[model samples]
Target: MSFYLTALLQGLCFSGIALGIYISMKIFNIPDITTDGSYTLGGVVTAVLLTHHVSGYLILPAVIIAGWIAGGMTGLIHTKLKINPLLAGILVMTALYSVNLTVMGRSNLPLVSISSIFTSLTVLADPNQNTGLILLVFVIVITLLIGYLLKTDFGIAMRATGNSESMIRALGVNTERMKIIGLALANALTAVSGYLITQFQGFADMNMGIGIVIVGLGSVIVAETLINWLRITSVWISLILVLAGAIIFQLILALTLSIGVDANLLKLVTAVFVLLIVSLPRLNRVKD
Candidate 1:
């Protein structure tokens, strides 16, 4: 039971990254690979600040800003220099590896003795339960806020820019600016996931963000299927389903481990799982 509970909490920590990927890939149709680096960047920033006695709340904005800058750089490279979006994201992600190392000044940072945002919360009686509650609250708040934003005028513009770039551009919308904002917002959300995971796990490792994009992509793909089957039209419901997808993905992994799968094969299993999810829909279309 405890193992399943831990997986649920970890899934909630990853919900933010799923949301980020939904924005970048689903909304903007951009294959932004900056997630790998910006995620580590967030963890690095959090570890450095926490170790230096910085307030946990303050670290949130700092991480967001750092991620925003990283994402903005990718957007600028793609939009201004006429580079491919994939290549631009690759460049920024590669650069962020060195930047994260410089920020941490080490390959890993332990936070066992340092205070964390989870430690400061007094609402939960069990210390083990505090992290889960806090993560739930964070995910709920962010989901609602993003849902609300998607209904706003600017958010509609962003969606329009993604759907029909030339049409929105002709209508006086700055498509380039919208793309930049979308990417920045996506990366900011991804950074928040990194921040939460680092605090929850009690340490930050430079390699923690490796191949994390697959997790986010898997979650989004799952959510997309749910949205279609459920005929979900409300943005809020769609967002909730996306978060649920993250939790479900983690649960699947937990189940796999419980069934005695080798830990060394976990990454391979994850890749195969995501590949199946991505291919199934296309297969159905072909059958139809």
Candidate 2:
């Protein structure tokens, strides 16, 4: 039970990153790979700043700002320079590799000695509450915030911009601005998740974000699949599915770990998971 709870909490914490995927994939109809690097940028920045006595409060915004810049670059490359969206993301992600390394002041950073946001929970408990509560709080806040955002006027405009960008531009909506803003916002969320992960887990490896895009997509696929299962065709239902699916996917991973699965095999697992989800719909259509 404890293990399950822990995994669920962790999943929820990381769901911010998954939500980023949701924004890019479902909202923007864009395939963004920069998340793989921006995530690490968050961790590295947070870790480096905290090591130098930077407040967690301050470090968060720092990480977010970093993510925004990275994502906006990707958008600029795609929209202004006329690069393919996917390739633009790849270019930014590749560049972030060195940037994140610079942020950490080293190849890695460990937050064991640094007081993390989750550490406060122990002051009110048996001193062994772990980081689950911290994850829960963050997840709840982010989920509510994002859900609200998607319902706002700006959110509507943003969604419309993604659906038919040229049409939006024709309506004088400045689709390029919307795309850049959405990408920045999406990646900012991802960076927040990365910051929390590093703080809670006590380490920030430069390569920490490898396969992260796949993991984020897997979480979204799981979320969307569950939404579909519930016959959910509305945006509200879609939001709920995203959070629930993140929790569910984490448990799925936990189940694998409990069965003595090697951690090294996780990439392959994520690939298979994504492949199945991507193929399932098409296969069903063929049968139909």
Candidate 3:
């Protein structure tokens, strides 16, 4: 039960990246691989700052800014330079590898003796419960803000830019600027996940973000399936579903591990799970 509880907390930690992928892939229709890099960027930033005695809360702004800049660079490459979106993300992600290593000055930085955001406040008796509560509140706030943003006029423009770029551009909206802002917002959220997860795990690894994008993509795919099956149209409900998707994804992984699967095969298991989720709607359509 405790193992599953920990998995649940981990899913919450990943909710940020899941939401980021929801915005970039579902909303913007871009396969922004920059997530893989920005996620690590967040962790290293947190690790470095915490080691230097900075307040956990204070470092969040820096993480957000760093993620935004990385994402904005991808957007600029794709839009202004006329490069492919996928390639632009790849370029930025590649560059971020060196950047992360340089910033951390080591491949792995442990926070074993360092205080983290979870330690800043403790209302619950059990430490796990306290962490869960903190993550829940954080996720809720972020979801609300994103949901509210998507409902505003500017937010609607961003959506329109994604749904029908030509039409939105015809209406005098600068589609490129929207893409830039959207990617920036998405990666900033991804960075927050890094911030949370590093604290939760008690260390930051240079390769921690490697293939991490798949986690977010899988969660988004789950949310997309739910959205289609339930015909959900409300922005708030859709965002909530995305959070549920992240938790569900992690639970599935936990179940796999509990069943005695080799830990080394976990990545393979993840790939297979995501493939099935991706194929489900198509399989259903075929059945129909």
Candidate 4:
């Protein structure tokens, strides 16, 4: 309800996007254009279940599993069929539109009186107190846990799979498995974010996921640019950049919305942001 609390919720939105981008781009190197669809899939799953009186905790995992399947489908198509990774993602994303439509049984799903994670976790809080702060805390904790997971051996293998699948394979690692696993983890997180987004925003449009991939990629690129500019080279630094990028992305969106920016233009703005981040190194001619 308050300004600060709204700002925190906005920040958490970006944090979710950043974490999704990190998993798809950084860990998997899969260039997952399918995220946009998987995102909506999560929302649709949550909304459908919530509409059917599913428990909040149960819906969380359901949406996550739904996301995993969506992403893993892309991985399977790419690995088994040898489709171009980009094209594979596109195909999966296309299929998800219909799937999302089916999940909602038409177009969009609404959470009229669903109990969200925040509502359940805030029983002790003042009825008027800010719940966004509590929700933001959980988002931060999830982000930190994801970062820690990426540091473990499994995470190392996942990262390595992104850069050089052959190298990881030669090292006795199952690169294909890692790719599948990475997509599963990444999309599951996206799904959870979508689930949270639906609960937080109180509605889920079947098409709500459009442009989300670009937004997530933009945040990741912006974060990477910031850290690379500073010559930061640690995994921790990358994680920080991911979080920072997401926060900054949301701030930019909020600012744009406050200035009465056209809703459609926001998609263009996201594209431009990604272009800027992707092109900066070449423009400066000093990428490495």
**For model 4, how does the per-residue alpha-carbon lDDT over 158-222 read when each residue is reduced to its tens digit?**
88888888898999998877887778777887777788778778889988888888767877888
Q: Which is the leading candidate under TM-score? A: 3
Tens-digit lDDT track of model 1 for 49-149? 99999989999999999989988999999999999999999999999999999889999999978989999866889987888888888998999889989
Candidate 3 Cα errors over 4 Å, as ranges: none
- Flag the better candidate by TM-score, 2 or 3: 3
* Candidate 3 residue lDDT tens string, 1-288: 766898899999999999999999999999999999999999999999999989999999999999999899999999999999999999999999999999999999999889998998889988998999999999999999999999999999999998999999999999999999999999999999999999999999999998899999999999999999899999999999999999999999999999999999989999999999998878988999
lDDT of model 3, residue 108 = 99
How far residue 102's Cα lies from its native spot in candidate 2, in Å, is: 1.5
Report how far off residue 98 is in candidate 4 (Å): 1.3
- The number of the candidate with the highest lDDT is 3
Model 1 residue runs over 4 Å out of place are: none
Ten residues in a row with the worst lDDT in model 1? Answer: 120-129
Instruction: Write down the TM-score of every candidate.
Output: 0.98, 0.93, 0.99, 0.90
| Higher-lDDT candidate of 1 and 3 | 3
Clash pairs for candidate 1: none
Output the better candidate (1/4) by TM-score. Answer: 1
Which residues of candidate 4, in runs, are more than 4 Å off? 1-8, 123-129, 286-288
